[model samples]
Target: MSRFTELKREVYEANMELHTRNLVIYTWGNVSQIDRDASVIAIKPSGVPYEDLKPEHIVIVDMENTIVEGDMRPSSDTKTHTHLYRHFESIGGVTHTHSSYATAWAQAQMGIPCFGTTHADFAYGEVPCTAVMSDEQIQRDYEEETGVQITDAFAVINPEEVPMVIVAGHAPFTWGSNAAKSVYHAVVLEEMAKMAYLTKTLDPSRAPLKQAIIDKHYMRKHGKNAYYGQ
Candidate 1:
């Protein structure tokens, strides 16, 4: 078997989980897992239905977004995945999803505010939104530019602390230490987005989550002082 067979299978399962968890519809999402030692990424193929996807259908690409294995074309968002793998040194997986609630926030060009501890548990604070791409950027290689936009949005935030970002007018993209974790983040992000939206609708005057609570919830689940998850 090819060395990448295992990586491909892992990525395939992650992508399948997106569908299984109802995080995606049709071919609206993709997941990629990076093999840092090999400097390659195994990602979903472009436009393929998740139901019919197989492990071999996963495309393996390098950091430069060059196809290194597999017969199928890499995902349209392949550049975004590659750019993130190159820039976000700590993340080993990337997921792009058009999940409804999260995509609603993205379309509104708003961040998911830290409205409660549930959100703070995963993200230190708000889940940030990227600035809209310039017309020049939109007109040329939009996928690559999307990657740049995501990286630029994280200039002040620690990717390790907040693993998710919503693209202005687009949708959410999440990353983690591996493909499965990235998908997990996507699921949590969607739930948080739903809660935040309901919180606003129910109490428009609700204040953003207090910093002290944010710090406590976030730290308890992350950092050396973390005490969450046994």
Candidate 2:
């Protein structure tokens, strides 16, 4: 198959996965994948339902968020994704999902700490929740400013310990080298949010995961001699 065909298929499948996981309702979520050389990104069109998302319906846009192909408009979150793809050199895919539990945490403006092996398996520390945007900035740039808010939040905190950042009062934005990995992170984030909420309900002051435990768990599967899928 040609590269364009594959890129189109990937964008379709990733959008479908959002509906499959019930992470979105109506048209609340979006997914995008960069070209083989990162020249452009193929994203879901705005306001289109999951049932009707087709490869022909996918919108191709440059890193500047200008449309390069497709007839329909790109997702409203295009600017946010474009900013990430442009600044984060290693990232090739970006996903935004209004998944319930995760968004709930974002609304609370609290980070998801590593409290169990499941959470530790992916991140070494807490999953950060960014600060809510200032009224002036929101009034100025809105979505584009969201990208700036998150990026600055990471700089204020630390990303080596937090791969996922929940946009305060909004949803989760996840990224990886590809769409599949970004979706994987989103799903894991929802599950972890659920677990964290439940644990805190039982004990309001529960502590985070120990450094040794988090390190061991992360290294075992991601490091040597870990027989997970193999």
Runs of candidate 2 with Cα error greater than 4 angstroms are: 1-3, 36-38, 156-161, 223-229
lDDT of 1 at 192: 97
lDDT of candidate 1 at residue 213, scale 0 to 100: 93
At residue 17, candidate 2 shows an lDDT of 89
Model 1 clashing-pair count: 0
- Model 1 vs truth, CA RMSD: 0.7
Clashing pairs in 1: none
In candidate 2, position 215 carries an lDDT of 82
The number of the candidate with the highest lDDT is 1
- List residue ranges in candidate 1 displaced over 4 A: none
As a TM-score, model 1 comes out at: 0.98
Candidate 1 lDDT for residue 165:
99
